[model samples]
Target: MSKYTTIAIFGLIAISAILYTYFFYFKIEERLPIYQPSQINPALVDPSLIAEKDHRISDFNLYNQLGDTVSLSDLEGKILIVDFFFTRCATICPILTSNLKLIHDRLPDGVHILSHSVTPVADSVSVLAAYAEKYHADPSKWWFLTGSKDEVYRLARTSYFACLDEGDGGYQDFIHTENVVLVDPSGRLRGFYDGTKEKEISQLYLDLATLKKELSKIN
Candidate 1:
């Protein structure tokens, strides 16, 4: 081939390679959707908190297992996973905690997990401390939280939409569910998983990794 012809052929080969990389190797990941109050099952959300769109987790002031106060602001700029359970739960709670432990082990720094006690009347700070210890949870990375029964249940049903039970968090009220909710650094609800199922937990890990990649592109 002539010199100009050889140069033209090389340019075409380089252009083809770049296009192939962009189309096949460099994929733009689809981010998890930001869940809105209306998108959630109507029964799971408190009637007062439901909005047309762009519903974010409400602020909360609750105590972790160490009796230290924790709030939504404390978790600002951090990815979070949240779940609701009681220390006394004997059925699926244990499985959920174990699966969460797996995520906690693999999660990147600045990622945190919050577990709220549904039966806070019985699960005092001491009880929560023991539960956290039992799970070998890292206090800084994973928090076992306890608060007023009413406040906890209100957050569960209104802010997180984590349970389907209906009640006022009164004396006879109790909430139970297997959901593990994923929240972004901006406090948006991104996804939900069945905490008791291994397959769901695996999917959560994959989604978490995708979230990490998404955040990296922005930063």
Candidate 2:
């Protein structure tokens, strides 16, 4: 074949390869699916269910600061503001926890705050207890949880519907956002906030108060 013919054949192959890869291998979700409890079951399921449920975070058994299991079911009747962080984190974790403390302080009795450690292996009950003390975490009110690497990642992504990727560091690694998840008394997700921002978290507090007003009628 002539040189021009060979060049033309190469260009076509490159285009075909690009098309194949685009269609088969590269699927990225721009945003997580929003899950409302009302959409739990249906005959013809909505297409968003898988995405939503996959990103939804729930209580898998995790050890709290005192080494007790704080299962998702255990939080069924109370309002919970959950987030992810690790004690050893030199970046965003401290800011998130300090902001959470403000929320914990303002929330009326019966409301709870939970922070799950993304560094699961390094944050066993004893390790987390030391970290919690550093934050002055009140075990009766705020719970700093630590568990297996798999369980923590599951909670961060599936339970809390926040980004905490293991790919950033392998099984012992986690990638995350500064998110504070607000779950209503009925286990329904109510709101989310940027844990690093005081204004946003303060707004979360106001929203929590509004939720408190509504939940009180049932109490």
Model 2 regions more than 4 Å off: 1-57, 164-173
CA lDDT of every candidate? 0.89, 0.73
What is the TM-score of each predicted model, taking all chains together?
0.87, 0.71
For candidate 2, the lDDT comes to 0.73
Please tell me which predicted candidate would have the highest TM-score against the true structure: 1
Question: Cα deviation in Å at residue 115, candidate 1?
Answer: 0.3
In model 2, residue pairs whose N, Cα or C atoms come closer than 3 Å (at least 3 residues apart or on different chains), thus clashing, are: 56-158, 56-159, 57-158, 57-159, 57-160, 58-159, 59-72
How would you encode candidate 2's per-residue C-alpha lDDT over 129-197 as one tens digit per residue?
A: 988787777887889887777777756654555663334335646555797888776666777688999
What lDDT score is found at residue 190 in candidate 1?
A: 90
Model 1 lDDT per residue over 70-92, tens place: 88998878999999988888999
Against the true structure, candidate 2 reaches a TM-score of 0.71
RMSD of 2: 16.8
